[model samples]
Target chain A: MNSAETALFGLPWWQAFVGGICTIAIFSFLYKENPFYRFFEHLYIGIATGIGVMATINTFLWPTVLKPMVGADRIPFPDGTYAEPYNEFYLLYLIPIAFGSLYYFILSRKHNWLAQLVIGFTLGYGGGLAFKATFNEMLPQLEDSFRPLYVAQQGAQSGIDWLATLSNLVFLFTLLTALSYFFFTFRRSEGGPAEKSALAGRWMMMGCFGAFFGATIMARMALLVERLEFLINKWFPLFFA
Target chain B: MDSSARQKDSLAERLERIDRRVVYLLIALALSLPIIFGWKLPPAEMETADSFFRVVDELQPQQGKIVLIASDWGPGTQAENKPQTMIAMEHLMRKRIPFALISITPYAAPFLESMPRDIKEKLEAETPGETWNYGTDWINFGYRPGLIIMIQGLAKASDLHEVLKTDVSGTPLADLSIMDGVHTIRDISMLMEFTGLVSAFNYWVQFFQADGYRPPFVHGCTSITIPEAYIYYVSKQIVGLYEGVAGAAWYETLLTKKYPGRESGTALKINTSLAVAHVVIIALMILGNIGFLVRRGDS
Candidate 1:
């Protein structure tokens, strides 16, 4: 027997058995939908929700908000002054807490407006940030689009650098055509300049989608390979020998 | 009567109506057999991975400055993101650079705790006498639920120690020797986001800057997000990018080259399986296309 097999890293031996069962249940859908898959799916959602709720309370709420308001975070000095990172104004936290709690008003038929109040406020806040962030995020990209058509040789070089200049030309072509595609007013039947550009734009968009599809396939395959490895190396070994 | 009634099925008709279960079984075999047997392909060197390694290698551990890792991956992308995060974090640890892990997604909380500790244990064991104690080496800032608001707020705050007052545990950030020098957004040396979420990357690019002090940004994206991630890279928003498990394998390759005899990671092994799976899928696609053409001709 291998030394590694003798001990399971403090995890009970049943842990792997359960993990194996859950994995098989999920994969059972590949053959046909079954009750095992449905049961495990529900179990997964319940467990994930439970973990998320517990983590939020343990890590954020209890420590950040509740501890301060209730003075659980306070450590007293020898002389009785507060030694902890706390303030008397923590009681004001109830205002935001009360406001956030309005989210549960979504359950109330008549009082759903209370939930809308918080939602609207949050949307406005997000919209304002998005406006500022959009400019910050995009301006540099816009600036980058102004690629130099001509590459000057520097440091003892004499002629144009073909590779970099070729790349720039490709970028310029791609950008103009891709952006021209959004000219919604131009009709494809007209066969005008906009039509030609828009056609080119459509091709570029298709190319982008194809690339995305290809990468998605690779990513999904990686996941499948990993799970297979887990099943082979960890799970299957339990039955053998 | 039997001979007339039982006309032989054409290859096109048979191929066109392949049972999905059969295809699934083929895929299962293609993915599994390589791992069960000992088949592997060496990871290819990639320019993206090279650049990713370079930026990390160029970094000097400065007092009051630490690398901020946006560990934004969860269970869905653990296949790609886990290895990517491990390699990058391993690099940072090997360099003896102090780093902090922060996650905006609730799903990312378990990873923030487990991954770093795992790396610390591995690194410490492999290299004797190297201490990777928490707080001194790295800190976990746990899960922050508010995504963009939290980021922008952190950027605008004058004092990070005040805003981000505590570690994952309830322990005060001020008590951590690492946080002594780190006070503002400007104190960060670099930002490395490992995530599959496109919006997570966008938030950092858009808002993680103040006073024109934008730290050099890099990313490790799941394979699916690589195309979008490349746009950021080309735009110069992201200084370096390593794409998926293949990219992680490439980074590990760089490490193996730099420091010979370093115990290799499983990225290459997983990537080999991925490559084989790709070949099987592509071959099936070709066969399926041929079947469609033949059936169309028959019709």
Candidate 2:
């Protein structure tokens, strides 16, 4: 569908107008802090918050929880048998519902401890899961870290893959040095192997940070380019096209 | 030397403390002029994005198998993720592979509709009569609640039809022709996730691996998280990576090479703009440094 058909959001041209205005209002902050930027910023926050709440409830909670409990999801035959059986187990959703409701108790002055009960339960559950998740995510990286120093490709006699070996060696060096840099509790003398390793690690980390910072600038520039593109291609066309 | 000559309003002094607004204007003009005049050229393809394109392009539709796309970004990172989503989605469509869109972020809900429609329009414009209609071509699973919980639920679900029940529009998944043969995570041919959030990406790696059967995973990450995302790519956890808009631009370059004469995507244009802006920034930085050195020597 074209912008002409995306009128579900608003009139094709009207949406652009509103968007252009909002974009300019938000961009006004580059000059100085002003009511234009402030108003649009708050408007965006309000709209986003409202959308988040409604979408969470309508798309997730209503279908996942309430419909199951209310049998709104079930298709009943004339004889009162559901095509999809409504398991009484659906009522078990209420336990979580009740448990999650304790979060509202945080607003209460005296009964704030009630909120902590669920908070503790959630934290404990999440903490236990994080242990497994961290391991799940880390183990592969650890395994990949252990590469063959000499990879013999085509045939073992053909000769070791120097490029692969060099890459692996570089990886190992980076891994060890980066790891050593975090060994803050360890004591090392000046110009010692450990100290040198840590320094190398710092340099490598700085290089990585530099790449990250460059990427960040690129990302921000991309964003600016987009707003400018919209102003030129989409917004300007609204008036001139 | 006289005090008057010492306190001269020279070019070095102007370079040393140029107003930030002027810098912004210069940067904006550097970015905008090329776009206005159309010097936008496709960037050199990166090996990583080529790997990404090859992975998606190599996907052949099979019975009980389809791509699962996580359009897990919002307007905030639209500059990068939007093009990434488009390039990936366009490839999937070009290959005629059925796919489903899911997101853990509520903000991604609109993207689930708009991105596909954007692609559909583009495809239709290029090739008449080959329209990408919803329900048959793609299905929006919409925003699922908790990331870990949602991913884990998808992993454990024995029957996805029963689990998903309906698409974002409240249409039953069973009714959608695209949902045919798509039953479990096993049927997911490839899992492609595009997002700006590293934590969300982490959850996919952490929880999306169902029954030890992780379908070839690919990631399109925002520039901020590209450094971290590489770990997954290098670890062989994700088979491919789109590093940012740069990655997407490179992938688009590859696609344009494959299918010449099609209207080029905005990734290349935006990327070119970024290149020009980088040049302007570098020049400014050089001038500023020169000014600093000159002032120090004078002192």
Candidate 3:
């Protein structure tokens, strides 16, 4: 059967009816805040959280921890294939289980230090990783910032490579001025070069922020457009068509 | 109060105090009408998206070159990230490229599996006698915790099969036919990250690509994150970037161009709606500002 004939989630017409109601209920907030919108909002959050928990257990916990430890006799396949798995080394996982249980000691006044040990170790490991990550992440960007303001033509017939030089020059100027704007070492005189460059940097930063704001507006509009599309194209047609 | 004075006050004051509900209604109408009536607006192809298509277009199938998809998005960003994920999967499947998916965010695991599965099923239905078997075409590693560390492990591991022990279904990674020649990070031809969060792209770049492990990288991100990602693209850390819905629409156009008769999907419809909505917003902003300026002049 095609989409129109087939039932979504096995509920025939009720699926579309319920979905249309939910969409309208959510969109009802345009007029004013109401019980309808609030109800669906809460419903969405609750459903999302419940689904997240179940998925985490079924996908992450089962395969990574429980199934590996217990060694199920039959592997549950989506296609209904039964596979054998022998039970062995179930006890080894208990070590980490016991160690992780130490996290509960934070509830106690006296044994809170035990929990602190785990926290400290986790922080230290994270800090070490961050140290390495910072260098790897920032260095390439820093290196790439060094652009040549002039370029010689290799194969192209274009004369003087003016655009390439202008692009690099603008990048260099923006980088320097932006950095200077943040320099709080010693106050410069009122009309000094330092102050002028700093002012330029402020304008450039504002321009950058404007671009960011424009992009944000576009992204938000995309979300609105998508919801409207769902309501009009997908949900509305059930009754109207 | 005199009639003329009252008229001026009402005009400017009413403009300033126009109920937000009216604005919301206008926005809703602007977005809904175009979609309901089936209006089409072609999005301009972006340079970033063009570069992204070029990279994926270069890939040859079944050459032992795998693509790694780092999917880190969830329901909150389904509008943007879902289309991005779907189009990328469609491209990979169409090209017959072997790819593996892994999610760092726990919430994204189901999406990582389900979206690709849906696309695969749809493609199978459309093409006659074309087969995309689970084990042979693609595999999912599902969700792994330790976002940065997990990527680092994948990057440094000599054998990817040992690192990623099993697929989402609990089948051993070694059992999949797609995993035949895929043994290490070196086997990956390209890495594409479809993310709502910009930091996930940073982790991939910092841990995987920038550390002298040079697999060509591409990013598909929410429009909010696109500006920041431009730095990486300019720096050559990423070969290309796709910016939200418009980018996805452009990618779909390219796909249709390559393989004619492909259906213009949700991306195109949403892109047109977005164009209308943006115009409405800008007009409102202008009108609001004009009211503000007129009130200031009167005062």
Error of 1 at A30 (Å): 0.9
Q: What is candidate 3's lDDT per residue for B160-274, written digit by digit as tens?
A: 8888888888788878889888877788889999888878888888888434666999999888888898988898889988888889989989999998866666788778888
Best by DockQ: 2
* Model 2 alpha-carbon miss at residue B280, Å: 0.6
lDDT of 1 by residue, A94-203 (tens): 99999999999999999999999999999998899989889989998888888898887777989998888999998887788998888777456677888788788889
TM-score of chain B of 3: 0.95
Across A27-135, the per-residue lDDT of candidate 2 in tens digits comes to: 8999999998999999999999998999899998898789888888888899988898767888998998998999999999999999999999999989998998999
DockQ, all models = 0.72, 0.74, 0.60
Provide the TM-score for each candidate, comma-separated.
Answer: 0.93, 0.93, 0.90
Evaluated on chain A only, model 1 obtains a TM-score of 0.87
Candidate 1: count the clashes: 0
Fold similarity of candidate 2's chain A to the true chain A, as a TM-score: 0.87
Which of candidates 1 and 3 reaches a greater TM-score?
Answer: 1
Pairs in steric clash, model 3: none
* Location of the lowest summed lDDT over 10 successive residues in candidate 3 chain B: B205-214
DockQ head-to-head 1 vs 3, winner: 1
lDDT of 1 by residue, B1-299 (tens): 25422332266656767889998888888888778886878888888888999999999888889999999888878889988988889999889899999998788998999988988888877888987979988999989867887888788889898888899887889899988879888889999999989999899999999988788999999999999999888888988898889999999989878877578777878888888888888988888888778767555
Model 2 segments beyond 4 Å from truth? Answer: A1-10, A74-89, A151-162, B3-10
Q: In every candidate, what fraction of the native interface contacts is reproduced?
A: 0.77, 0.76, 0.73
After TM-score superposition, the amount by which residue B222's alpha carbon in candidate 3 deviates from its true location, in angstroms, is: 0.7
DockQ of 2: 0.74
Clashing residue pairs in candidate 2 (N, C-alpha, C atoms within 3 angstroms):
none
